[model samples]
Target: MGQGRLPARLGLACCLLLLLLGGSGGLGSRGMPRGPWEEEQGPVAEGGPWGRARYEAVKKHLRAVGALSKQYWQYLACKVWQEGCEEEEEEEEEKESSPSPGLEADLNEQLHGQHLAKEVVVRAVQGFLQSPQPQKALVLSFHGWSGTGKNFVARMLASHLYRHGLKSKCVRVFISLFHFPYHKYVDSYKAQLKKQISETVQLCKQSLFIFDEAEKLHFSLLDAIKPFMGRYDNKGQVDYRRSIFLFLSNLGGNTINEVALDFWRAGRAREEISMEFLEQRLRLELLEPAENSYAHSHLLEENLIDFFVPFLPLEYHHVKLCARDAFLARGLPYTEAALDEVARMMVFVPKEEKLFSAQGCKSVSQRINYFLP
Candidate 1:
C-alpha cells in the first residue's frame, strides 16, 4: 500500500526542484541548458568573453545544484521510504554489550520519582555484563505499586540491551494472574515454565526472562526456575550466567510507601531514604510463609536474586511532570492548568492530606484524550 507513495513523493520533489530553479524571469527548458551553449556556440573559441563567463558561471551553479540535489534526494528518500537508515539499527546492535549509559540516561529522563531504580539497575546490569565469569544469572526484583514505573524501567533495560527490546525473541515476559491462575495446574505450570526458560536460554546466548506480579507466582513454579539460576552451571548444559531475570511485583509497595511517609513525617529529605532502609523491610515481607508465594521461593532461600530494586511511590509534582511528558508525547498543546487538571484526576492517598498519587501515573496517558481537540 505504501509503495505507491514513493514515486509520488519523488515526482513531487522533482516538480518542486524544477520550480525552485525556474523562478520569475528564470531559466526554463532550452533557455539555460545543463552545459555551456553547445549548438549555438559550438566551442569555447567561437564564444566571446561574455559567453565564456556565462558558461563558467552556469557550470559553477550546476555543480553547486548537483551537490545539493544529491543531498536533497538522499534526505527525501530516507524520510519518505526509510531506506539507507541502518545507522540507528547498527548503533542499537552495538549498544547490546554496553548499555548502561543509555539505560541510565533513559531512566533519568523518562522515569521520574524513582531515585534508587535509576541508580542501581543500570549499575547492576553493567557490572553483570562486564563480569567475565558470573556465578549466576543477574536477577533484579522490582517491588512497587502499580504505575510506579517498574514495568517502564524493565522496558528501558530491555530497549537498551536488545535491538527489538521486549519484542525480541530473546526476551520473555510472564505475567502472574494471566499466565498461571490455577493452583490445580501448578505441576504443569512448573514443567512449562522450565521448558520455556530452557528453550529461550538455549536459543539465545543471552536472554531476559521477566516474571510480572512475581509475588503471586506459585512457589513451585518459582522453584522450577532455580536450576537455571544456580550458582554453578551444570556440566554440558545450557549456560545461563549471561542471562538476566527481572521479578516485578507489588509485594513491598506498601512498605516502601510507609518508609517514604516516615521520611516525610520526620522532615527528612526523600533522597535520604536509603536502599538499606527498604531492603530489610521488603525481605521480611517476602520471607513470611503465610501470605504469598515469596516465602517458599528457592531464589530467596539461596540468595540467588542479586538485587531488590524498589520503585517508590509518586508525588504530586512527579505526576505533573509525567502529565507534561504525556502531553508532549501526544503532541497536544497544554498549559500549566491542563497539567494540573490531568494530575488532579488521579486519586491520591492519605485522604486527609492527599500526599501521594494512589494509582501513580498509570492511566495518565489515557486520560489525556479527554482534553483532545
Candidate 2:
C-alpha cells in the first residue's frame, strides 16, 4: 500500500519479490491465491476473473476430493465391508452397479477402445458380431513395454462394435492384464477357462472370446482355445456357429535384435533381444513347466499363428495399413511419405517376417513421432 519509490530498501525488496515470483515453480504454491485464470472466465457460461478462478479452483478441488472419495468408497466397500459389513446402501449399489456375474459386460467394456491392429481386429470382431447365433468370439491383445496405445486401440474397436449395435450382454471378451504371480491349477486351468466360456455360452447364447495381453496368461489357456480359433461351429452346448477368436500381441520379431544392437551401439546393452528369445521368454513367463508341453504341442498342432490371421493372406497386412488409414481418417496428419515409410518398413523388406513383428508398425510409428526433428 506504500508508494513504490518512497524508500530505496522497500523498492529493492519489491524488486526481489518480483524476481522470486518470476523464477521457476515459485508463484503457484498453496499460499498464493493468484492463478493463471485469475484474469477471466473460461469458455463456460459464467465467465469472469475471480469467478473463473473460483470455478477452476473448485473444479480442481472437486476432482481431488472426488478421487479421494472414490478411494474411500472402494476401501469401505472392498477392504472394509469385505471384512463383512452388510450395510443397505452398499447392498443397493451392489445390486445396481455391480458387474454382471458372468463378467460379459465388464469384459466387453474393457475391450472397447482404439485397437492398434484395427483391420484384423475390426474384421475379426465384425465376423463375431455378424455371426448368425451363438458364435464364439475371441480376441487376443498384447502391448509392449511402456506402451499402452495397443490396449487403447482394442478399447476403441470394441466401442465401434457397440456403436454398430453390438450388445455387451451378448458378448464375452476375456482380457488378461499384466502378468502377476498366481497359482495355476494345472489340471483344472483349461477346465476353468472352458467353464467360464461355457457359462457365457449358456447365458448370452453367443460369445466373443478375447485375450488381452494374451502373452501373459498361461500357455494352456491359449492352447485351450485352439479348437475355436478358426471359423467353426460352437463346441459348447449352445448351437452357435458365428463364434470368433482373435489375438493382438505386441511380441517383437528379429528386428528386436536390430533394436537391441542399436541400443548397444548407443551404449544400452541391457535391452538387446531377439524375436525367438522374446517368444520363448513370453512362453516361459506365462506357462508353468508342467503345462509347457501341452501348450506348445497344441499351438503347433492347431496352426493358430502367433500373428493375426485373416480370411485371406494379404489381409494380414491390412491390420497395420488400415490402422494408418484410420489414423488419417480421424485427422491425425498422416502423410504419403509416412505411409510409404511405414509400408517400406513393414512390408517391402524381404526378411520383414523374420525381422520385425507388430512393432514394425507400432514401435516405428512411435519413434517416428518422437524423433521428428
Candidate 3:
C-alpha cells in the first residue's frame, strides 16, 4: 500500500510540469520576452487592442500616397488636352462670326434694276444690325410681277447673312409650287410648317425663313405664322427676334407697276416716289378681294409684316443693264452694241408708248446668248 501511494504522487508531479511547459509554449508563440533595453525603451505591445490599431495606421498611409499620385497624373493630362481643345473651338467661332466680303460683292453685282429696293434693303439690314436686342423678327414682304428680282434679292440676303449662304441648314426655303402644291392638303401643310419653324428656331435663333410665291400660300398657313411674328421678351418661350422672314409674292404687282409708271410719266425722279405713296395702293390691292388675287389673307389686315418692298417694272435701260451683268457673269466680252441689241429684241407693252419691258429681265439670260458673239 505504501509503494502504490508513492507512484501516484510521482504521476501527479509530472502532470503539473507538463501543464507549465504548455503555458510557456503559448506565450512564446505570441512573442519573445522583452530584453532589458527594450523594457527600458518601452516594448511595443502585440496581440491585443494595439495590433488592430497598427494595421489601420499602415493602410491609411498607403491610401493617402495613392490618392495624391492619381490627382497629379490627372492634372497633367488635363493641361495637355484641354488647352488644344479650347484653342480649336475659339478659332472656329471666329470664322463663323466674321462676315464674308465675297457675298456682299455678289449681291451688289446681281441685283441691278431697282435702286429704291436696294436702298430699302440696305437700311433694313442696318436696322437689324444696330439693334442691341430686337423685340420682333424682321418681316419683309416683296411684291412685284414674276422675274422682278424678288427671289434674287431674297437669295442675296440669305447668302450675305449666313455662313453657308443659301445652302446653310439654318436657312430654309419653301416654295408654294413644291412644298404646298395641293390646296386641299392645307391641314397637313400647316402642321408641317409649324413643326419645321419650331424645330428650326429651337436649334438656332438666327434662322431664316423664305416663302416663295407667298401669294398662293393658303390663308390658314399665314395665320399659323402669327405666333412667330409676335414680340418676344426674356420671359417668353424663345427669343426668335433675331430671325428673318421674307415673303415673295405677286399679289400687288399691277398696283406697284401703275404707281411706278405714273411717276415715270410725270417726269418725276424715281426717288420721289415715296414708300408711303406706294403703300396705300399696295395695301388696298393686297387686302381687298379681287377677281384673281390672294388678298383675302389676314396677314395684311393684322399688319404683321414690317416692310412692303415694291419692286418697280424694269425699263429698257434696266434690261440692258441686266444683259450686261449676265454677259459679265458668263465671262463674255463687254460691248455696248450687244447690250443695246438685246434690249431692242425684247418686247415692250403698250405698242404706242413702249415704256417698259413686258417680261422685265425675266428672259435676259435666255436672250443674252442670242446677241453673244
List the pairs of residues colliding in candidate 3.
none
Q: Return the lDDT, model 2, position 234.
A: 44
Give the candidate number with the greatest TM-score.
1
TM-score of each: 0.74, 0.37, 0.71
Query: 1-373, model 2: which lDDT tens digit per residue?
Result: 2465447644554565444333322244454444344434455635433555566865775576556655545544454235334354345423332222322333333322222233344444555455555323353434343232454444554444433222354345555543322536644767777776666555443345556555556666666756555445544455434444445443432332334335445775332333344445444443443433324445544544433321111112433564465555456766666655554554322253442233333454453453244
Candidate that would win on lDDT:
1
For each candidate, the alpha-carbon lDDT, in order, equals: 0.83, 0.44, 0.74
> For residues 109-165, what per-residue lDDT tens digits would candidate 3 score against the true structure?
777667667777777866875688887888899988777789888887777777676
* lDDT (Cα, tens digit) per residue for candidate 1, span 157-241: 8888787789977899999989999999999888898899998877666889999999888888888888788776478478988
Off by over 4 Å in 2: 1-116, 127-148, 163-167, 171-180, 230-236, 253-297, 305-373
Candidate 2, 316: how far from true, in Å?
26
Worst 10 residues of 2 by lDDT: 307-316
The local lDDT score (0 to 100) that residue 243 gets in candidate 2 is 41
Query: Which stretches in model 1 have alpha-carbon errors above 4 Å?
Result: 1-100
Model 2 TM-score, 2 decimals: 0.37
